[model samples]
Target chain A: AQTVTQSQPEMSVQEAETVTLSCTYDTSESDYYLFWYKQPPSRQMILVIRQEAYKQQNATENRFSVNFQKAAKSFSLKISDSQLGDAAMYFCAYRSGSNYKLTFGKGTLLTVNP
Target chain B: GAGVSQSPSNKVTEKGKDVELRCDPISGHTALYWYRQSLGQGLEFLIYFQGNSAPDKSGLPSDRFSAERTGGSVSTLTIQRTQQEDSAVYLCASSLRPSGPTEAFFGQGTRLTVV
Candidate 1:
């Protein structure tokens, strides 16, 4: 069984600043995928960024990027130039290439200050 | 439909009563999934449907819960004798593939509040 962990229960960042949410997971599979999904107050799960274990280069989607350390079993999400819209409960999820099911962490509530 | 749609956005039911939640996945998607989100349990996968067949029903919490899909489109999750702990947001997602790195589009979710 694979389990994802988000250590930080809450995070705060000022507008235009950068913030990073930490995530770690336990899995035996050699190859897998990591994802960061943001659930706003509206309750829609939006995919922020995705990273594959085989890829050495971190995944970057404009302001959203990931720092994936496969050896350390850590995959952190970095949000650059944070905006108000970025305020939400961010969940770190893991999926093995062999399975369709996704394992998600407890989530970190991010509050972007103006 | 353009996207996954869930009906009865919010459902409030009495304890011990039965409740049914529906999900309409993407038109062409062959894979559908049901997940539960609550303060206690983050997001847990309940079942996976590959074109109306559920190969994985591992995450369902108890025997009171069961889900099925028909016509390879809509799915229904039924909970018999619901408990207070059953209160949570039931989310539906759909993807093109049953395995691998495909993106899964999600529905707004049905907030099930069992009182």
Candidate 2:
């Protein structure tokens, strides 16, 4: 079974600053995908970024990027120039290449301060 | 629909009662999934359906939870003898296929409150 872990329960970042949310996972599958999802006050789960285990290069989406260290089994999300709107609950997820189910971390609540 | 849709945005039922939650996946999606999200907790996988095949109910917390997909499009998650622990937001997602790394589109979710 694959399991994702987010050590930080809560995080705060000042406006216009950068923040990084840490995530780790345990999976025996060699082929898999990692994802970061954001849930705002509206409670809509929005995809932030994704990384394939085979891809050595990290994934970047505008201000959101991921530092994926496959050997270390770590995939961390970095939010650059954070804004108030970035405040939300962030979840790290993992899906095996052969399965459709996603294993998610406990989640980290991010609060952007002005 | 352009996106996944779920019915009964909110449901409140007494303990031991039965409840059903519905989900309408994307127009062309062939894979649908059910997950439960508790307050301040991560998503708990419940079931998975691919086309018309038998669903993968491995993630179901208990036998009290069951789901079925009809016509490879709409799905219903039923909970028998609901318990207070079952109170949570039931989320539905759909992807293009049953395997691989496809982006999943999620619905607003049905908040089930068993008192």
What would the TM-scores of all predictions be?
0.97, 0.97
Q: In model 2, which regions exceed 4 Å deviation?
A: none
DockQ category of candidate 2: medium
* Chain B structural similarity (TM-score) per candidate: 0.95, 0.96
Report the number of the highest-lDDT candidate.
2
Measured with C-alpha atoms, the lDDT of residue A58 in candidate 2 is 98
TM score of chain A per candidate:
0.98, 0.99
Question: What are the C-alpha RMSDs, in order, of all predicted structures?
Answer: 1.0, 1.0
Candidate 1 per-residue lDDT over residues B1-115, each given as its tens digit: 9888998899999999999999999999999999999874589899989974645888899999999998888999999999999999999999998766678888999999998
* DockQ of candidate 2 against the true complex: 0.76
lDDT of 2 by residue, B1-115 (tens): 8888999999999999999999999999999999999987899999999888888999899999899998888999999999999999999999998766688888989999999
Tens digits of lDDT, candidate 2, A1-114: 889999999999999999999999999989999999998866678889889899999999999999999989999999999999999999999999987888899999999999
Residue B81 of model 2, lDDT score: 100
Docking class of 1: medium
Error of 2 at A32 (Å): 0.6
